[model samples]
Structure formats: structure tokens, C-alpha cells
Target: MNYRQEVEALQPQLIEDIKALCAINSVYDANTVAENRPFGKGCRKALDAMLALGRADGFVTHDVDGYAGDIEIGDGEEGICILGHLDVVPVQAENWQSPPFVPEIREGKLYGRGTSDDKGPLLAAYHAAKLFYRKHPDCRKKIRVIFGCNEERGSSCVRYYFEKMPACRMGFTPDAEFPVIYGEKGTCSIVVRGNYRGGKLLALHGGTVANVVPQQCSAELLGEPAEYEESLNKFLTAHPEIRAELKGQQTHTCLVMYGQAAHASTPHLGVNAVAAMAAYLEKVCPGPISALIHRKLTDYTGAQLGIQAEGQLGALTMNLGIAKYDGCKLELTLDLRIPHEVEADALAEAVRMQVAEYGAVLEYQAGRALILDRESKLIQVLDAAYREIEPEGGEPQAIGGGTYAKAATNCAAFGPAFPEEDTHIHDSNEYISLTSLEKATAIYYRAIEMLMAD
Candidate 1:
């Protein structure tokens, strides 16, 4: 059968596998972490589910101490690896129309936390591998589908897995947009902390992860409740997109504001709750903390911090993701996506100097960038496969998002996410279009066939 026919035959099984994997609330939880399950019980459960599927499909599956697992097919000295992750970020149940973990199909879109971000794409690639092997059992190279449990927090799971095993000769990860991604910006995370003098600002909290823009923030301010309520009403009137609520008594008032969430790589699409709350507090809480927020944290880019740069990989983007002030102490986490042309340490020092001006301590952690030659054999093959299916598709491009391509050798992000569709990755109501999933499966099958062909 042709590639499309094969994918059509496997669509039901693929959808079932994707749904089964998406049903697990695989967010990393340290509280349930154990010997083999380093990430948590939920993540361990997700890993086992994938391996179980592989075993039932008559493929050799191995779980690398719960940190990662792989399903292997074929036999040869050289191998091809397709890396993906099963762990998802924490979700606000109230924000989603449907339960985040319960996979649902509506209007031809599969809605769930992992459906668009990863689980859907992972299964698509797996089914492609299965189809290729079934048609060509004597293919010369082995195919390995590697799944990790800690990609959301960090790639420690894959790091440990790679250290234990040898690198594949060639591979691609279906975690980003299609055509193909040849360059990915460097990632830097900064934690800013300082003493907070309790005044109008008694307590503040916002955000869940550093890579996602915070959609909600709450603050307790020292002020007359009625006056604060009036001010909040005015703020809401001016900015209808942000919803605010006021509570508490006469002397102290609590405020909550809701904004839109998006991935840090594309912060312009999000309305950061941390920034919005800080903007409001700048007027009521006149202090160093508020000053820092107004001066450097409000913008999506690092222009105010004097660290912004633009290059082939794109402009440096920043997300003021998490913020908290507990009456006397304050902490803010910043996620920055840096272009390949910029120096990460130099940028970090500049950010450190900027935050230091406000008496805040800065700690930086950097993830190295990945850049592959567009003319390389791997890129050529993947690009050809995509163009074969999508005749008018654009050429391979750069991205700000980091993927397992950096963790694996000779790899780049090839996709299940189409340029025309918004997958809402790392955001609320995340879903994958069924058409995109099918096309991606066929592309993966074609790419694998071309790569393995002599």
C-alpha cells in the first residue's frame, strides 16, 4: 500500500494510542518521586504506558530507569532515533473548557494537554515507523522511538538516557513546526530575588512554569477595600481583556487578575499576568520591587534589560513567568530565548547588572543553542519529504523553542505542527487537527523510508 493508504489504515489505532497517552496526568511531581520513578508517579505511569504499547506491538521496548524509555525495531549497527517527551506542564483545571487530561475530539480536533504539544506527534511518528518496518522488514538500519519523562521542567531525563546509551547517526524530533527547524535559539532562565518591605503590597503570586506566560496573578494590598475596588474597576474598564476581582476587608484588600497564556518563545501572543499585576502595583506599592517590575519586566523582549538581540534564529524574547512576594521577601523568574548569534554569558551578566541596580540578586542557568546546516543530508532528506507532500510549503527556518534535537546527535525538529495551524502548545485548550496528524504520519513514513534506503 502507498504511504497515505497505510496511514489511513492505521488512523484508528494511532488515535487510540494518542488518547491513551494523553489521558495520563504526567506532570512532574517531586512528592511522589521514588527510586525508579525519579520524576513522579504520574510520569512513570506515562512511560510504562508507552512501553506497554510497544511491547504489545511486538517491538523490543526498554525503560531506562523511568527517566526515559525506547521502542526499537529492525537490526543494524547504525540507528535512527525519533525523540519525544510524554510529560506535560501543570494545568489550571478551571481554565480549560474540557478536562486537560481527558482527551476529547470536537470539530475534528483532538483536545487535551499532550495531544498537540507532544503525545499526538509522538504517536504519529511511532505509527510511521511501524508502517515502514512492516513494509520493509529487511531495512538496513534500526529505528528507535525514544520518550522522556522530564522535558517540561528540563531535559534531565534525556540527558541521563543519552549518557547511558550511544548517540544515533541521524534523527529528528516532531516537537516543533514543520517544513523543518535548522536553528533553535539558546535558552536562559534567571531567578531574581530580594527583600520586600511590606507596605501596600502584603503578598503576591503568579505563574506556574518559567517557559509559560502566567495567566493569573493575585495580590494582597494594604488599602481601603472600597477604594481598591473602585481602582480595580477603572483598570478593568480600560483593559477589558484582563479581568480583575477584589476581596477582603476595609484596611486590606486582595486583587486577582486574569490574562492570556502562551509559550515563552512567542511571548507577544500572551498577556502576562505577572506584568499586569506589577503594572498595577507600581502605583500602589512604590518600592524597589515595583520599580524593577516597571523598568525591566513588563516588556516581552529584553530591551529594558539591555540584553535584547536579533539574528537568524530570531529576536531575543523574554517571559516574566513566575512572581511572588510574601510580605517581606520577593522572587521573580524570567525565561529568555536567546538567538544563536548572541553570547549567553555576556547577556546573563548584563541582566545581572540590570537587576543588581535594584538590589535584587540574579541567578542564571543557560541551555546551549542548536544550529544545523540547512544543506546537510539530514535536512535535505526531511525538507524533501515535506515538500513532496506540501508543494508550496516554506523552506526550513529557525525557531526560539528548544527541543530534544539539542540533546541528541545529528537531529533537528521536524513536525506535526503545521505553519497554518495554531497548536496552542503550552497553553490552554491545546488541540491537534486530525488532518495535520495524518499528513505528519505520512511525512514521517516517507522520511524514514528515504533515510533507510540504500
Candidate 2:
């Protein structure tokens, strides 16, 4: 059945709801943790807002102890699930032309921090399920739209959810690129820390999380701002691609570098500010942390670290997501997307040994990769639903992104992001096109109808 008209009819409310939800700075805040508010007050508010939306529409909703929440439609025991996250990555507000939390529409696209990440897609799934049951009251099929508050960090919210609730029959997460995703790169975060003493650098900081390329990095060095001005100008002139400036403090000079931010899965698209700052530091200050970062982090991939690998899915990638050096201690967080062909253990050992050369200690946390057969029932049904709408769409593909699908069984990342469209998720000026919003809503509606049929 055609759902274009029904999906379009919901656009006005959908936009308003998107604005309301995206307005909350749902970035995980450790400072605001409490009993019922785990991720933070922001995420807690987003979760409550979503659950309230479900309840207002007459659906049964569960709080799942504030780590996550779900809205249940229909009274059936067996059903399909839709997994999504309400928590978003941290944003560098100065990079945005419009306030990151204040969503606005410009030229037919909704722009906000979470507009294209998972919030927009999550609502699309919600509206689709709402539309489905509204159009078919007698339908016994169930749809549970799960919202998690810890996806950007580690998805502990959904992990806590399944501990309290049972997994559904089959499901999909509308948090990735279009057509369908049957394979995703395994993800891991490696943090290295060490001591740095008697260096020109006093303090260095960059990036927010281990999943996004840092957009801005600032370092305070032991010198006059005027002392570094000529050298900084010379450096910027020699390296025209890098954008940086020196800020003066009484006894120290602060070197700030600005780079483009992109999701860690696609680090090549962004210029890592930390790496750029390290390059400059290696020349002027020449400390262990700066030298190591300059030597190791210049490449987006892990070729310098010798952990790069290629498999059926794709080549491995690494993002120097977070870096900090406070007078005495140095820390760096690297986010790596590994292919199945490479052993994660071996890669970790290699990185650990490399970092040890610089007198640093390494800690690694590994996650599982997802790989499903192309002919599986879930893939077949989802592909059919997608093909029903766009006959010329691409086949099921693999991505470097880690989605909620990995946290559940019999699930994969599905549409919300069209292949040709770059929503600039996890970056400044992130937006979701009006056409994509309506199209994704209709696609979810069709997928739900088809999944419920069988």
C-alpha cells in the first residue's frame, strides 16, 4: 500500500517534534547522573520526551530504568523491533553557524546536532509504527520502538535494556546509510597515557569522544604569544591547509587549531585538529606527546601504527578522536574500525607495543563486528521493502559505523541516510533533508507493513 500521502500528512507535526527533541542537548553528561537519569539530564530529558510522545499517542511505553525506553504498539507477544538512540555526540558549538541545540530549517532541511544522527531517524520509525497501527486497527503485529540514551558513548543503555527485557523476533536500526547494511566493521577504543615533564607544552586538549574526529584543538605552551606569532604565521603559510592562531596569556602562549569534524567511521572527510596541532608542536615545542602524535596520527588510517588491515568488508580505519596533555600526564584516545579479516587482539598488541616505545601504557576495549548473509530472511524482507520504493537502489553494503543493531540479535542497520546524501552527522551544520525525512518515513512504514505480514 502507498504510504506517501500518510507520511506527508505527518510532516508538519514531525518537523515540530523533531525540533522539540533536537532542542535538548542530549550529549551524555557525567555530571548530571542520578537514579532515574543515567546518561545525563539532557539524555534523560530526551528519553522522557520520547516516552511522553508515545504515551500521548495511546501506546504503552516502558522507562527501562532511564538507560533506555521503548514504546509498544499492539498487544502481540511476537513482533519486530526498531532500535534507535536519543543520545548524540558532543558538538563544538563555535563551529556551527546556528546554535547546535536550536534547530532551524534552511532551504528545506532541518539543521541541528541530532537532526541526522539518530534522533531524526528514531522519530521516523516512531511515526511509521504509529501510522501502521492507525491505518490497521485489527492488525495484531507489534512494533517496539526502543530509544537508548548511551549510544554515542558505548550503548550501555540498550545493553541494560535487553538485560531487563527480552529481545524481539527481528529488528532494524535506522541509524546508518540506505538500502540495507548486513556487515559493519568491528569497533575498538584504545587509550594511551603517560608522563611528560619539562616540556614547553603546559596543556593540550582536543576532541570530545572517541567516535568523532576532533574539530578544534588548543595547546598552551611556555612562551610569549608574540614569540610564536611569526613562527605560527610561517607555519600556516608553509602548510596552507591548516587553520590556526596563537592567543596570548600573561606567561604562556595558547596555540589553537581548527579542523573539520566528521564521524570516526569516515575520518578522511575531516581534518583532525589534534593531529594538526601536534604537527606544529613537533616543530616548535618538540615533546614526546607531540612528537608521537605528529609521527603516528598524521594518517587517517593506522598505517603508521602498522595495524591497518583489509578484508571483504573494507580496509580498516582509525580516528584520533580525543587527545590531551596536562603538564605532567599525556593521554590519547584512538577509535579504530577493524575488519573481520584482522584479529583485534593482534592489532591491540601491536598498538600497545608501539605506544610502549614512547613510555606510554595502552588500554583497549574491543567490540564485535556484524556480518549477515545476503540471502538471510531479514535481509531479504528488508531489501524487498526498500526495492518496493526505489527499484534502482544499491545492494546491501558494509559500513564502518557501529549502530544499535550490533547490540541486538537478528538485526541490521537500515535506512534513514540515503546513499548519495551526506547528512554531515556528528559534524557541525548537520541536517536532514525534507525529502529524505518523508522518504525514510515512508520506507519504514513499508518495511513495517511487510515485516508484520510474515
Candidate 3:
């Protein structure tokens, strides 16, 4: 089958679907909760519209409560599943020339929330399913398009659905980079909480989400702030890009630090405001928190803490996304992506030791990380589909972004993120080019077709 040709024919329709989804303000809003479903009314409404769209196309769609749902195409027997999420990261309209939610097209790129992270890929998968059904009306394997709504916050949506649905033989999540992902590092969120012992710092704050590298930090301090003002000023001069301030003309002031925000998965690519605050704070106010920064927060490349954790998949890294310390107490949350081969308990022990010095406690949870064998049919088939477009001959690599692939049987992250091309997913001005979208649809079509066969 000329899947690429079929994908080309559906390009206009694909773009229309993405625009329609993006226009719905589908970001997870907390206020839209009357029933405890986290994402607000608009996001839920957008999800419902997506399910409705699938049903309108003559497919059997199922809504697993309001958390997530799936659209089944083709009849009987297990087949390949195409997993994608409906939830999107919050948008900042001020950063873009056009509104972030409105999804404007300038210079051939679709600008909006979920365009690159998910909605674009979701539409591409839907068209691939549609093309599959159209081309092989009597196909043997059934195809399912899973729609998850709480992927960004937590995958509670899909977790609930999996409890009541049939298992997919193999699948791919179109939520990450292309050339496909062979391994996804283990994800663990560690938060250290303790008392500060002193009574000077008050109401420390930074970061909106645990997964986003905070671009700003603020802490209210007491006592002779002027004593440290000179040193703080020197520190600020060295890092001119950031905004640091000791608010007001009085000794009681709030120190604020600013940096560029980006996702925790790839921390090296972002400017972590939280880490900077801790680094300078450690030097200015030498203590457990600063020690934590030197040992853990400062290294996104995982070069320190004697945890240069690496494997055939990739090296582990930490993103100090959120921090709070009032001279009397402190709390730090770190997002870690570890190789599958590494033991979670062992790593947790290492972290436990670090926080133990200050009587601080650590809390951790393991997010799923699937490593599809390179020799497996699933990887081989997926590789063929990607090679058809980019013939650079690079093997599928590992990633830190968590996806639905780890939710069930044999699956890996495929497409939406082309190799070596960073569109800055989970950051401001997130977008997917028209060319990339088309290539993704073509790849998904071929992959779905090939993997569904006996």
C-alpha cells in the first residue's frame, strides 16, 4: 500500500482536525471541576469533541468515564493500538505573536498548545486509522486509538481505562520524538521536606508544576539583609540574564530570581530558575538547601551526586522543578529520568542518604519506562516506517518524556518529535511545522498497517 500517498491526500483534513482541537482551549484547568475530574470544563469538552469526531467517522468509540477513552476501528481479534493524549500543558499567550490557544499559522507552522506535544500527533493518528480502514476494509487486525486526558498531570485517565479494556498486542505513542524511541528512561519524582531550624527565610516559592523547570523564584528574608546585599549584588552581576531583586527599600526584602522555563525531561536545554536560586543561596546562606543544590539540583546532565547513572539507553538526569524553604523549614522536589537497567530502590537509597543529613525525608514513585528490544518485531517494523522518511540510519534512542507506551504491552514513543529536532515541547511557543505533521501522518499510516499484520 502507498501509505505515504494516502497520507499526502489527507493533509488538508489533518490540518483542519488539529486546528479544531487546538481552538478548544483544551489545557487542563482546575476550576472546571464539579466532579473531581481535574481538567476544567473546556478541556473535558474538547476531549468529548475528539471522541465524537472519532465516532462520527464510523468508528466504535468508548469513553472511560471522563478521564480517558478509545476509538476502535476494524472488527474483532487483537491488533495494534495507537496511543495519544488529549491533555496539553498550559499556554502563555503573551510569549507568542498570536494567542497560544487560538492556534495561528505563520510561516507554515501551527502555533498553539498541544500542537507539538500532542494534538497534532493525535490528529495524525486518527487520519492514519481512517486511511487504514478505507484501504483495507476487510483487514484482519483491529485498530484502537486511545485518547488520554490527564497525561500531562498524571496518567490517571489511562490507568483507569486499562483496568476495564482489552490489552493491545503492541502499540506506539505519538507523543514524543521521531525516528522512534527504543527506550524511555525510568521517571521518578522525589520531594525532600524538612524544617529550616532558623527563622529568617519565609514563604519560599518557585515553579508552577513539578515537571517544569521553574523560571522564577522568590523568597522573603528577615534580619540585616544589607549585610548580604553586596555579595548578592555581585552574584547578580555575573548572571546578567536573570532578574534578581530584594524587594523594597527596607531590610526585610524578597529575593527573586528569574530564568527561562522548559521541561524537566530534558533539563540541559532549559535555564532552571530554581537551581540558580539554590546555587546562589547556598553560597550566600550555606546550609542543607545549598548543599542539596551543589549535590543534586545543579546537574541536569547528572554529572554530580556520584550518580552519573548511564546505560545502553541513556544517562540519568535531575530537574529541580520546585523549591520552598522558609528559614524554619524547606521542601525540594526533583524530577529524575533514570535508565531502565538502574534499580529504582538503589537510586532512592542514594537520594535518601543526601537528605538524611538535614533530617529531611524523601518521597519517590516510579513511572513506567518501556524498553522495546531492538531485535523485536515491534521495533523492526517501527524502524522501517521511520526510515522511509529520514534515511539517516540512526538507531532509535532513549528519552525522558513519559508516554502511554509504558502503560501496556510492547510499545515505544514514535514520531511527533523528529530526530535531533527540538521544537521545545512543554515550553512557551510550542509548535509543529506543516512539513513535520505530514511526515508524521505518513509514518503512522505505514506503521499501523505493518504492525497490524499477522
Candidate 4:
């Protein structure tokens, strides 16, 4: 079948499906979590909605205790798989042009929370597979499209699904940039806790998740209004890019700092509000936590922690993704993307030692790096499929972002994001273009055809 023509013909249906899926507000709610719905009501609804789509199209669907679900195209035991997630990172709706859950189309772009991250890409791959199977219904090999609901929160959904199910022959996830991803850096998050005897620094908070650079940070300092206003003004003058304010309270002053948010994998692209606040505190209300954050957390390269390293995949990068201080105790979660050459344990130990010096304790969870050989058949096939779709596309590359590919065997994260386009993923006004959807659908169709060749 002419894949491009088929995808183009189905644009309207595709857009509606994307809008419907994106409308669910599946952000992994902990409040409504239950026995079957492990990721909570929002994610469960998303998983159910996706399964309904598959079942409507005469495909076999399975809900794996709500942690994840799968739609199978055939009866064969093992074949190609398509991995995609339904859960999204938390969003500050006030920053969006429209209600985030209400999907909108502006200038040929579908705007919503999960539109760019994985939902749009997930459905693109789904429609592509649907088209392929519609042409080859009698084909023996099965095509399993897995829908994960906890990808944003450490991919526990896929982890549980794969644990309960069999691994596919090979697959690709539509969760990352175009061309193809052959390698991915290892990801780890370290939890640091420290106690502050100083009464000047009161409550502090920042960030929503451990994978996004915090855009806003606030700290309550026990002091008069006049104590911090002058110094904050001078600091703001020095760094005009940072937006901050001092709100006076009866017994304390609230210092609010604002910065640009970006995916933790590319921390350099973001201005971390937590780090900026630390810098301000280091200057005015100097304390152990502030000094530690200012000295070590400000740099994304792990330079201050003395654990920077680079490998074939990429360099080590870090983000101060979460921070909280409740008057006396401070807690922080630092997300680190480590290259393959650097041992995750060694890196964690180095950070632990550094954090220990400032009277803090640390605990970590390390996810190993994924390195697929460029010369491997899987990479060659995926690369060929991408090149066939876009002749002028760039070579396959490594990314610091972790995806469902890390949890699945014989799979890598393929298209959805084009290098030139900024989808604003993990931020407000996230979107997926109509052009991207059509192109990626065609690419996935071609890749599935090639993978399932007789």
C-alpha cells in the first residue's frame, strides 16, 4: 500500500483520535489509585479509552491489571511491538493558551498536555499499524501495541507489563525525536535530606516532577520585609533573565523565583528556578542547604559534584528537579542522566559523598543505559525505514531522555519529534503538528511493513 497516501487520507480520523485521547487529562493521579487502576483514575481512563479504540477496530486487547494495556493485531505469539505511554507530566494550566485537557488546533498544530510527549505519537503509530494490518490481515506475525500509563513516573507500567508478558522480537517506541535513537543515557534520581538549625530559612518548595527542570521556586525566610528586598533587587538587576519577587508576611518573607522549564535530560536548555533561588539565598540568607544547592546543583554537568563524564552515548547531565524545605528539614530530588561509560553506582557514590559533607543523607535509584549497536539488524532496519520516509534526515543518534525503550527488549525510541521543531514537551503549550503526525504515521507504517516482511 502507498503508506503516505493512506495516512493523508486518514488525517481527519487521526486528528479526532488524538484529540479524544489527549482530552483525558491522564496525569497519573495518586488519589484515585485502586486495585485494578494502579496508576489512578486518569491513567486508567486513558488505558481503557485506548483499548476501546483498538477493540472498535476488531483488534484483541488486554488490560494488565491497569498498570499497562496491549492491543494485538494478530494471533501470533511473537512479532514487532510498538511502545507508547498515556501518562503525562504535571502541567501548570495557567501558562497554557487554552485549557490543557481541552485539545485545541491552532495553525495546524494540535495543542494539549500529552499531544507532543507520547499520546499523539502513540496514536500515530497505532494508525500506522492499523493501516498495515488492514492491508495484511492474514499475515502470521502479531503486532502488539503496548500502552503504558506510568511512563512519566519511572515507567512502572511497562515494567509491570513486560514482567507479566513475553518480549517481542523487535520494536520501536514513538516517544522521542525523529531519524532513530540507537542509544540512551542511563537515568538516576537521588533523594537528599538535610536538617537546618538556622531559623532564617523557613519553608521552601519547587518543581513538580523529577524529570523536569523546576520553573518556579519559593522560599519563606524568617525576616522583616526590608531584610531581603534590597538584596533581591540587586540580584534581579544582575540577572535580568530571572523573575523573582519578595512578598511580605506577618512573621516571614516569601521569596518567589521563576525560571524557564525544560526536560531534565537537556538541563542546559532550561533556567532552573531552584538553582536560581539557591544562588540568591547563598548571597543573602547563606545556609548549609543554600550553599550546597548554589555550589553543586547549579551546574548541569555534575562539575561541582566532581562526577562529570562523557561516553559514546553522551555526557552526564543533572537537574535539580524537586526541592522542599519545611522550616527545619529540607528534601531534594536530583535527576541525573549518566552516559554508558560512567558507572551509575560510582556516580551515585560520588554525589552521596559530596552531599554528606553538607550534613545531608542520600538515597538513589539507577536505571542503566541502553546501547544498541549501530551495525545491528534492528538499528539498520529502523534507520532504513526513517531514511526511506525522509531522505535528507540526519543519522541515528543517542539521547539523554529515557523512554519505554529502556524497559523493553530489542526496541528503540523512533520518530514523533523532528529535530527542528520544539514540541515544548514537559512544558505549557505542548503540541504536535499535523505535518509531523502524517509523516510519522507513514514512517511507522513503513517500519512495520519492513519489520514484518515475509
In the predicted model 4, the residue pairs found to clash are none
Show the colliding residue pairs in model 1: none
Estimate the TM-score of every prediction. 0.98, 0.98, 0.91, 0.97
Q: Which ranges of candidate 1 are over 4 A from the true structure?
A: none
lDDT of 3 by residue, 255-341 (tens): 888787788888878888877787777776666666766666578865665566878668888888878776666778888888888
Off by over 4 Å in 4: none
TM-score between model 4 and native: 0.97
Per-residue C-alpha lDDT of model 2 across residues 372-443, encoded as one tens digit per residue? 888998898889888888889899999999999889989989988887888889899999999989988988
lDDT of each: 0.89, 0.89, 0.79, 0.90
| TM accuracy, model 2 | 0.98
lDDT of 2 at 192: 89
Give candidate 3 regions above 4 Å deviation: 1-5, 29-31, 34-42, 92-97, 197-200, 223-233, 244-251, 283-288, 301-303, 326-328
RMSD of each: 1.2, 1.3, 2.7, 1.5
Candidate 4 lDDT over residue span 245-317, tens digit each: 7888677788889888899999988889999999988888788989889997789999999988888998999
Per-residue lDDT, model 2, residue 12, is: 92
- Residue 409 of model 2 has an lDDT of 82
Worst 10 residues of 1 by lDDT: 223-232
lDDT of 4 at 296: 79
